[model samples]
Target: MAGVEETEQVKGATREDTQAADREPETLYGISGSPGIVVGRAVVLRPRSDDLVRYRLEKEAIQAEQERFQEAVDQAEQELKDLRSKFEGDLSDTLTIMDSHIRMLRDRMILDQTANLIEQKQINAEWALSRALYLVKKKFDHIADEYIRDRFADVEYVVNLLQEQLSEHGQQFPTGFAEPVIVVSEDFTPADTVRMQSEKVLGFLTEKGGTTSHTAIVARSLGLPAVVGVENITERCRTGDMIILDGYDGRVCLSPTMDQQKLYQEYDRQHRAFSEELSWYIHLASETLDGLRVRLSANIEIPNEIEGVTYYGADGIGLFRSEFGYFQQKHLPDEETLFSVYQDLVIALDPQPVTIRTLDVGGDKLAIQLPGNKFKALHERNPALGLRSIRLSLREKTLFVTQLRALLRASAFGRLRILLPLISLLSELKQVQEIIGQVMMDLTDEGVPFDPDIEIGIMVEVPSAVTMADVLAAEVDFFSIGTNDLIQYSLAIDRGNEYVAKMYDPLHPAVLRMISRTVEAGHAQGIEVALCGEMAGDVFMAPVLLGLGLDELSMRPSAIPHVKRLLRHSTSRRLTDLAKQILKCGDGMETRALLDCYLASNAGEWRERS
Candidate 1:
């Protein structure tokens, strides 16, 4: 991109040539893309905002502006309604929220109050609109919850558009640009993406948007590399600059040397090769070289991920997270909707074991505006420790029963297993047992053909669960160690927290001892134990788990082949020695050194996989 300088359009003929020739060197704009380049013009999205003096309006003009303001709001409402109708898949709000919000928007109280501001304070429609929006947002933002605070962004985006129109400026899009163009804007908006289809657009650049924002979403869908928050980029870029974009690295170069271009082209080629190679290993069964069989399962969220499960040759579904449904919608789904989704998933994965955990929301996953009483306990200082998972379910028996009923009912359609989360006490499992029994009676009385003998289990996340594992193991058919939370709880360190994450080592001797005890306890009770957290995918920890007598490993599909390859050369006897060395370590580094030495000495096992 060439920096824009004084143009010949305003300069006299004597100085025009000098001005035109005085252009700065070009700089490239790095954006995400499909590993190719198509040079074209830039189309910038211009957001509309009001430029009128609303405070100076006379009474007659103020009244006129109010009428226009009402009309503009009506137009926005109809537009949202029409969009909802047209995009059926996008309609997430219930009838109650949908109709009530629209009603509140047009209510006399809202309009009268806005007009009162205009008449009483002598403010114009533009200021009135902003102020009213600000007030509404203030109430929602101050509601003592993150979810409600998040809604303020949506409110501000909508009001800003209307505010712009109130000042006689309106939003517009690029309709006639057939050339492959990169969108240039301060911040890319949804309207900008909707108007610029994936085919005609090459890429875009913006100085805003978080990694998960609308800009990044569109870029990923189109397989474009987008580096957001690039300060001073707009001022640097200009028309007709020879630009090369390194989408992989989010690098942009101006008038790049041929060597640099060749480097990126090779990088793109090798990356594609790696993805294709990974896909090739998907359908293979997992087994060690010496004939030790291993159970490989998929960790899934949506029903759509079942295809991936099949492709990865997963023996069964290990963890089917249930919170995604609750979070993706505006409100908690009713029993009927939840049942249908559960039933469909069970039938789809028929003849294969499917472990469904109850809604595991709280800590980072809690919701706001749920009738106040439901999650009020989660508002405490330490949410991860305060009323989460099984505790929350026991408190809200109706919600818990609803989920259990759906899970139990789905069992008839497939091999179903139910897992409880965050269990510290045996009484919590007793609550689960009671809820399941009560729901069974209700379902039987209601003539629902639900299966009665689905396997029940609990995640061994808390250290207390480890302490009481032998007794607790007798109550359930199996135990799945949720090492992510177990290590977090044991070390008092959150993985999300960078300062303490390094201290949250799963290989800490105390953590290793806990694993050994829990596995020993499960074995003593004649129940199966499996590693189901990120540790299951850890190559280093896999040996330790195997040493501790873990029967199964559940993890990301991509890690299975590599992990299985590691297990091929490893003997249970040799692995036991490694675990013993780890336990005898003087410090963490000694344990790590022993582990690394063990892996390096056994490197021959990972190689020459059949």
Candidate 2:
């Protein structure tokens, strides 16, 4: 209402046309960083570009310039330490990110390289620091994994801190908004996001960042509505401009009319009420009207997400992506660091099992400092199909062994499952089992404590793996279908490619058949089969997955409650029947329509009951 103006007269216009013409809001779209909706004033945080001056220093001034760089590094390190201390009891994910930032600040790549460049190139500290950041960016640019590659944002944050320290123009967090406001910036660092007071900050809009960036991670952890990767949001938005941030659809609307404002307000109210209602199912068992029980678990990447798992009443962690710790550091993490992280995760969920996925990234993504320089970075044309996941582990035995040792050690704390990724052949599973055996043997010889009979599993992702699921199922303890990759590889459609992205469908007949085959194979072996994919999080797909006889559904934390409620309200027998009909569909479109109809009919029944 504050930003709205009176409607203007239009000749021969209907009431709807007059209402629509009251205000024509400009909308911007981006990647959803988190899920929610809010309307607030825009607070644009423009970057300070004037401080980053690039100029050569005289020979006599080089010593001072090098010293200045070190001073800046020391200050940046101290600032990160202070920030880390501030969030000591806060989210563990925030602290982990802070620790990574502190490590980056002191890493030789930033600290030594910047100082070295100042002395060698005889340039100002700002210029030399920028050069070091350029080198770091160049290295990260070649990383094939988008999640790992997005970590460049962390490095950029560290560099920006050093730059600010050198120029003595440190940016302050925008404050003193009378009302909650949406913060728009070129990009947000994890520190900036973590430091934001949720009561004052309605959401976030950024010009640069992906969902995997640390900034986005913090935002999601905070339960804030955020839309990242919006081009020129800071440039276009001005302070006090009314903004509508829709995290669900990744949309931002500027200067909404009275009607538009009322619509979104109702949407926000319903969303809040629905979220509150979902909490009622948290304490209830994830079972259908029939007596069939299903394990509703969470797929988490960081330890702090442990909070979400417990809050959402998940059975346990279904897929713990173990690659984040490895990619966050300047060098490969040793067994001790790896064990500490894993041990914390296991200890936190003592009775509840934590399934840890082994390093699933490709060799091309491991550009970090490897011991002895033995592991050379492969420049594969298509890294996804190249030496990655299980293949990379086998080739780099030592790397794989170290991780296995750490995981085995952590298993001593609580229920732990080791998941190997991309096992296309029986031989791959056999080789990994052999290495795991050797690690167990060594630990035995050393009189180290471990779970000797720890369960092992494989991510049935590749098409070959699906074909050989029965063979692999016999060897492994369980099967976790990685439908994200399964759909991509099965359809030969690169989900990242705009041209073929629409073709990459989880509801495709082949994909559902593949899931059915994997479930059947796992059932034949008498092992649990779980789906830990984007599809698993989808409420509509929950019935289909249940019908396919999946023992578990592992997805993001926020999605757990919705899926749980769906599971509890519906009958498994009905879901199974629906799945049977859907599997008969010819294509994804038809499958979707049938699923939609089923959901609509069910919703109508639910409405009548209410």
Candidate 3:
């Protein structure tokens, strides 16, 4: 079949005539999330493992095959390099992740390992390469953390270069579909996402990956609409299945008729107009009609997320989780490496305060290097109640000191604050301070540079932190309640456990009481309190938080402008009164009712509220 660019035009056809032609009724349409048409033959990229040595071969043929294998690796690497150079601006740091894998594949260690296997055992190059890759794959799979485990895909990519068998037949892009090619894959790598051409390719539908997956990230970056985490996507989708992918709602329609396609086209036009209208708020501030100030910042785990800070116009970074560096990392980064990452961030942001949360791991966020026997024997069945956060620091005092030293050193580069997670008792804060003082003294003796007066705060995630707020508030510089965890603990429901999530409520009276008391404790002691959890980013909760007398709020970087707009209409006095009234409410519904009234009242003003 001829590609779209090569299609024989209908007699005397104009551009309008081309688009107006009735889409073949057989065409399938997912919601057209990404709006470009791809006209390429489908080339499936997959990870398939095999026993290479099973292929019996002569020595000379094996030698020839080894050279072929090496050449393929070299060619694949060059192709990756060419792609990177071509897309340098939009995808600068992205290809670097892939390049690392290429480097490893071409590294001496892998080459030597493969050669040793080939010479030591009577195996062909493909066999040797396959053996080595499987070993490497196992090493990555052994990682307990999901993030690191995902890296195994990179390993499989380069290895498959040596053993992949691809056939391109009737896989060419469909001319009869409503648009162009749709990717129906079990999964997509970041590399696949980058190679996707905006003009030729329509959106992608993957069988796996949630909103945070790399596929979603690249799809959003490319302005292509996409639907992910769709079970049985591949089964329902054929090369020419008429499909529509509604990115706005994460829904996809398979095999729609011409009438259905027309309706979707109209829907797409409307949705695009609505999105454009909403985008105007990007440069706008988050102030409400009244005169009140509320801080809006981002929660970031990746250092590459500096774009999120500027893109969203965040007031500052509320939470820069150090756990990503510690947990996803295979080995503990030395003080110099840690300092370099922090220092680069500090210098880049300059005066904006970056609240560095010292490694919050051991259970849900456990690092690889943490001792095995110690983590299990001493750890809790519920790590939420186990040796994590401030307590883990106390246990691994040396690691804590190393991290503290890095934070201090980075502070000299810019405004830096420390946030300690899971500080249920005053003793944890006192112990942390003692360690800091020692590090400061050691730095002083060693003549290292760091701001000794960097403000340190506690994450009010535990019931004890809220219950003993007055006492804990006295010793800490500030407090930021982590409502995601606080709600879980207070309501006795694990958020991750879907069966119990329905019981989780941010508006719960106990949760509200904890937040209000923590805020009161901090303000009474002449300190500031902020909410930096998922709740902080909730527009509905913004007014409730303000009413609770909270001084600052932080959330996803994308949420800043909307929350800021919500705040502009609020005032400390009005919110304070609301907080007082909430204190008198009987249950979570009462709090929800108060929030509903305020939301309904201000719903008209914030053009893109919530």
Q: Highest TM-score: give the candidate number.
A: 2
lDDT of 3 by residue, 239-279 (tens): 44446666766666655555766777788788667556546
Worst 10 residues of 1 by lDDT: 1-10
Instruction: Write the residue-wise lDDT of candidate 2 on 254-294 in tens digits.
Output: 87876887898888888888888888888789998787899
Q: Which residue pairs clash within candidate 2?
A: none
lDDT order, best first, reads: 2, 3, 1
Task: Please provide, for model 1 over 431-512, each residue's C-alpha lDDT reduced to its tens digit, 9 standing for 90 to 100.
Answer: 7888888889998999888778778999999999999999999999899989888988898887767688688787888888
Which prediction has the highest lDDT against the true structure?
2
Candidates in order have lDDT scores of 0.65, 0.82, 0.67
Candidate 3 at residue 513, lDDT? 85
TM-score of candidate 2 on Cα atoms, chains taken together: 0.90
State which candidate, 1 or 3, has the greater lDDT.
3
**For model 2, where is the 10-residue window of minimal lDDT?**
1-10
Better of 2 and 3 by lDDT: 2
- lDDT measured at residue 242 in model 3 versus the true structure, 0 to 100: 49
RMSD of each: 7.4, 5.7, 6.3
Q: Which is the better candidate, 2 or 3, if ranked by TM-score?
A: 2
Q: Backbone clashes in each candidate structure, one number apiece?
A: 8, 0, 29
